[model samples]
Target chain A: MQVNFWDRNQLRLTPVFFLAPAMLLFTVYVVYPIFSSLWISLYEWNGVGEMFWVGLGNYIEMWEDDRVHTAIWNNLIWLIFFLLAPLISLGLSIFLNQNLTELRFIKSIFFFPFVVSPVVVGLVFSQFYNPEYGLLDFFLKSLGFQPIAVLSNEEIVTFGIILAALWPQVAYCLILYMTGLAGLNREIVEAGRIDGAKGWKMFWNVILPQLRPATFIAVVVSVLGALRSFDLVAIMTRGGPWGSSTVLAYEMVEQAIFNYRMGYGAALATILFFLLDIYIAWFLFRVWLNEKGRL
Target chain B: MKLFISIIVTVSVVITTAMAGTLKITQNSSNANTQKLWKEQIIPLFEKENPGIKVEMTIYDHEAYKTAIRNFLQAEPPDVVNWFSGNRMKFFVDQGLFEDVSDVWAKNGLDSQLSAARSTMTVKGKQWGVPLTYYQWGVYYRTDIFKKYGLGEPRSIADLMYICRTLKKNGVTPFTIGTKYLWTAAGWFDFLNLRVNGYDFHMSLMDGNISYEDNRLDKVFDIWGDLARKGYFIENHASLSWQEGQAPMINGDAAMYLMGNFVVPNLKEGGLSGKIGYFQFPVIDGNVRTWEEAPTDSVHIPTKAKNKADARKFLAFLAKPKVQSMVAEVEGMLPTNNQSAAPTDKFLKIGFKVLSESAGLAQFYDRDTNPEMAKEGMKGFQEFMVKPDREKQIRKRIEKVRKRIFKK
Candidate 1:
């Protein structure tokens, strides 16, 4: 059989064409909703009534909304704590990576939390924080300390929820670190050892730098996870102890779906989207700059 | 070719069997015994009485069913779905989404059976749904706790404060509530609002004829703030579900809960059925005792339903005295049909007594108010619970929302 140049090229490219379906599905389901939500932010609709063009009214409302302010503050706390949580996990992973007798079991136990769903994690932690019957309260009472309602008081509720959120997140980071450690070059470690690089010096100069890819993945996921902190809040508190635990994602769902204020909810959602975008952009820019310097 | 022919025949048989004019009903009510009775007693009766008809049923958790119903209405609505009365159903009604049963209301004699109070369930002066059951909301307290603390069922605001003081000294949380969903707080606000300002204020607010900053409402907030400041409510009430908070009351760790008759079942589930006691939320002043809280449940046929005739038949069947009595008995609720036998459950009997004795019934806060205003208003109520000092700020914000929501 003879084939023309166009036919030959087309035949060669059929596999790539076959991938179009998945790409189309992704764009339709994921990309389109993001853009549509962004567009909806510019109007005021209560899901049933006529949509009024609100321009930037919803965004402006964010400035005056005390609940939104509290949410943003809580989100900042989540980002800071969530970002550092991964480093702690990585440290633990490295500690456990040493020649310990039960290292395999220890690692598996540490990784167990990540395998659980956030809803289960939230429920379990909420029970732990329960004032009357929870483990923490029981321990505190036994110690003759005042057993506080960790999930209720406005002063500490956000911190309690974030602690719950960090459990699964730390496990996630550990998995990444363990995988990164597996890919580490033994030759490079030996070369550092031969050059008198040992212990902290060895880890700081050689091992840490090599773990950059894993660290980048960890930070990105953590930041995104912190910004999208809804399931934990929903399961644990539903933005309560009087809206003290509301995050933007939860507020968006509550307003858009339950409250039927689609436009206002979209506006809140857009703010979350922008906040996430800025952090992700900064992260990528830093990575790009570092790569350029290496080049 | 033989296999393809066989597959086509099988598919046809399945479709024919599945779509045999069967009526599908979905509800969020999850009382297992009631569900069993509905299947074994009601369904069989409904099916046998109307030969060649079948009934299929599905139940969901309340929030899940709300989401499901909203989605289904936009896609494939059921023949009949249980729903809330008042403003919640109005959105569906306004969309031309529910079947107008004004004729059915008159034909089944519900117009007379249900009374003028039932008109709240109507939209645009047309009856769009059937009121299945409703019950009174009041203060449910642990009698043992009250007796131990030397307190009695509060009849007035001063008496209620006295009881709170007694309970506080005794180291019990004066009230137990979970406001995680925000609307539960509205129950307190609604009782206070009604007690402080009476039924007229509530009706005006529902009609969008009253301002959020009305002095009458301000007085309600004042009382709410006073209770909050006095530490009458459980700390961290916002972190728990209403059911979770019920535990403290059951265990005598908390002395009281402001709730509806539906909570009696939960109290029974908590093994406090005999221990629980009730009274109308104490009046702010002696004159305000006439106002009462009564939220209703109703079933409506959607306009877009494929089986409207069957749905209407089901509605008519539900309105029958026998079916009403069955629903009331199994569900432990007050039947809307006057001819329906009174509930045998003691707590439900108390609820019926309260309903009959009250001068008037006010719809629940969330239902009585427009949904848009209700959302913002309920959040304000929650905020007021959290920080009484936020009262002025919440009122201002609510005023802004009210204007925006009900603009002329």
Candidate 2:
């Protein structure tokens, strides 16, 4: 009845007190906003104006919205491309792991794209894809091919931005894979080689299962990255040539900020959150299973 | 205690400061000349006239200004704010964020002086703000290229088509446009609709009273589609910004561009100023090429402004012919005050002529229409340009957005 919440001497209370700042911050910034957005999603509120509640109207509208489908399709493309990043990064990490001369030095250079901001990365690739003076166009023209308008064409614009996104994404995955590869059990690898497990088989069986933690992290990051593919689409195409390149996150922000459709935007955010939440739950379950198997 | 004494001193100073009342003005531009005009001319002059009043100006660059205006206006309302005329302003005004300044208009007799842009400054029945500056959007063509091809300034739809044909024959694109940001396409739509169906029909459509799939819009898009299909626009235009589209015009590869007077500065930057000539977008229906896209920029006081009395004085000061002329000189913009002389620049003089002869004014498409509808409609316009065959689909898409946006 006379509990002192701030008592540091009490072990259980001490941990709670230690966690209090972070918990408070997380509640305010993360938990509160998530619920607030959910509540807002039920209303038809332009951010500045008074909110008028229209329960389920925004969700019903989303069901009929074709643009949502387009965004999902684009997000799917991003997901597909993102899945390749880990494999590519793993392959790249392994190749660089070899004690070739200056290989370590080359790695920092390769990771240069990751260090560059997404906005800068988007800008650089936009220049590369610019039809008139772009390096890609110039190279294609030199090769006796027609100059390609990748960003201009609606169908390919998402692909173009995704490819740009992958440049940095691959670097991040490469770092993750390299970290995983470093923590690999060398004796098991040596034993696998002794047992005639070589090359691809060595990678598939010996190296991979041990690298599960890193692979899981990379895949999770990639899925999140794909779902939240906003910056590249925003900077390069702006979901343009007719919303063909829009991803859910970008469209949500577009609706909220530009269109002043906060209610609709909040609905989009809720949907994106739920979709990601499902993936996260499945990922956690897989990790739990993997850990249980290890035990 | 020393702390107690310091606190007491601070309280009195704060009270004095509160009584003095700072008139905060938030503007969306930080142009060097404009800033200089504010510091050297307007602020100094206004302060001299009223010794007790202090002007606090907070300026933002374009992109930051766009979002910051909304946030700052509502949270810590400034006495005055700068915004675009027409629907963009109406958006905030309707939300009751901007203070009604019809009293300022009536007292100053602005209804007569600012007659040209008066309609645009009004939302519903009330004038929510005052138009301070505006610039005309029309066709800007390479004078030498036109002369070289004997392209008499296109006077009608037939004339425009003939120019396009003649330019193509000479291996020149008739018009260079970049729809990367989507609003460039809106410029095209505004002109075509204004020309083909005239102003009232165009305003009706923008007001969402007329449907996007109307026969009138069909006619507008038909002409636009024909233009696009003729290979008249810059190649790979959807990838380029309006600034990048200026390149072909600079190089004489494109004969003309339909853009705002803002593009004139870019032309100067591109070192192609003297070579370019201005023309109102030629008649389509030949009824009259009177309705021009001259998007007016307005100033307003927030309804919650602390120093409204000073803000009104500021707005009144902003409305004076000398101040308007100073703005015109400083910004290379058309003055809203009737008495202020238009700038003497060759291009500006012609802009004045075009505007003065106009039967009425139209805010540019994005400025005139609801933002949500404008976003979809511009996208539809961009798509239509790229694939004119999909005109019906595009119109339907825009119509769908319009219905959703305006219905509520």
Candidate 3:
């Protein structure tokens, strides 16, 4: 029997056939693991042992856990400051893009940090911040200022690391903004100029709205990057200065892998995943509503 | 056709023979000389002693080694691997991943040759590994700085505090440390914990029989805080490696560094060997103390070892005095075997003396405590170093961890 061309069933199977590869990947890596973690989170297994069912004990204990609170606060700080990183870089990119002389070279140099591995960046910045023979200390001493223990002082430890983290993140944002600028509508910009819209007025009215796609991507990535800040913290301080820099990601690794509290760590990870999911959903919803309003 | 068949058969026989002769071993020790010695001396000796046994060894740096060992133990356990003693080994032992070496220990008379403390190599009354070497952790200081300031090696806590005050007066940092790795702070805490609480208390605390919030731990925190508040450590310690922090100590900018005996190599690498001096971590409360934080290294044969008998033979060969002494000489470590000759390296001699003379040897805090508890406890200790006022809170957190880890 010959199959009918352009039939509804054929059309329905077409979409499934196209999606089969991605669906398989998702099932293996994402969907299955989510349920596996959920099941594991209810047990008191140390990754090796007789798995004991503890019900919601791990999740319940997370409520009174101060480390979790510290981790959450650090995550919030990361999210807040991390957002500013891309904004500042975007602003810088726009400003730099306005000047055409040797711009590409300068942008490339600025973007160099993003190209390097976070582990290498962390090690380099750690040396730069070293108290005794570090460049910062030498500069401070030359200026007759007492050296600061930036890495050890709990009060400023997070900010110290954030500065290191920002180095690469800012570069990333600049690259995104630069790409967005390259694709900007010249005709619309010319129209704005004809309408006497220039400088801040032109940017606010013409350029920024046109850059929404880049801005949205930048924000989403920065938020996720900030929430998932682990490598730099691990390399630089290992969430130290007395766990002042203990973000959720580092804490999860510590609890699950190092401490062998696989169940508790999984619970922490699940919470972080859900938290990010909620934030992203809210952000996308806001952006969708804004677009609908524009329409 | 006959020539081609002969060549193919010869190739197949050679491949099979190579595969049959190969013996695999993994070690977590990161010392460069140790790796070199393993390749040049240990492997050759083992191979010579056991004809047709070709050894393949993989070495890991400290942190990577810990993670790699855990990974390997879970996935594909190696034939023979270096591991720590005390509660650290107990976890793997409890999993039945290690071969019981009680017969080997008894046959070789290791029980009487090694110290009672080394019994930590055994779990559930069955010996599971062969102890190779151990070393003391203490205050390694710059002799030039001490001589410049007319300060003697600190004999007591009062003397140490006085030296700290003197160093501050002389525009020198009293101590150099890098808490970036977190466990460096544990060296200080281990000394303070031992001094403040004594040996029995330390054992009890490690075994989870004592609460972390006990006044003894508070007193340890108070001492640590006093050191911090007094500006004893170099200004930017947190940014330095335990080795990098030694630069200030080497340059005479810093007076002392509380570190393991292994730090001597790094100090020497930075061109400060001859200028360095060692002292036992000072006594508190007029007590003449001889406790040392001695982390021991051991080799265990896995139950799933490809060549179990060959692996056991390699472990036995490593336990011999000559092999231990040769390794000690190359690695600048104190050998576990009493019959092994002392390392000729001056720094290693100091370590040997300290380890030999100690009234009691406690495994370094991280090794003495179970790995799970050690992870949280060390982090808490690092936090305590940064914010002393958080002592009560940190103690409570540690107590909770203790309860979770030690729960039956």
Q: Give each prediction's root-mean-square deviation over alpha carbons.
A: 4.1, 3.0, 4.6
Query: Cα deviation of A70 in candidate 2 (Å)?
Result: 0.3
Ranking by TM-score: 2, 1, 3
What TM-score would you give candidate 3 relative to the actual structure? 0.90
- What TM-score against the true fold does each predicted structure earn? 0.91, 0.95, 0.90
The Cα RMSD across the true interface for model 2 is 0.8
- Please provide, for model 2 over B36-81, each residue's C-alpha lDDT reduced to its tens digit, 9 standing for 90 to 100: 8887888889888888898998878977787787787789878888
Runs of candidate 2 with Cα error greater than 4 angstroms are: A1-9, B1-20
Predicted candidate 3 versus true structure: per-residue lDDT over A10-38, tens digit per residue: 86789899999999999999999988998
The segments of candidate 1 whose C-alpha lies over 4 angstroms from its true place after superposition are: A1-7, A48-50, A278-295, B1-20, B148-150
Model 3: reference contacts kept, as a fraction: 0.78
Interface RMSD of each: 2.5, 0.8, 2.1
Docking class of 3: medium
Per-residue lDDT over B218-321 for candidate 3, one digit per residue giving the tens place of the 0 to 100 score:
77888889988777877656666676777777777887888888788788888886888999888885563667788888889877676677777787788888
TM-score of 2: 0.95
The clash count of every prediction, one per candidate, is 1, 0, 1
Write model 1 residue lDDT over B150-223, tens digit each, in one string.
78887788898999998899899899998767778998887787777788878778767888887878788888
* Candidate 1: residue A220 Cα off by (Å): 1.7
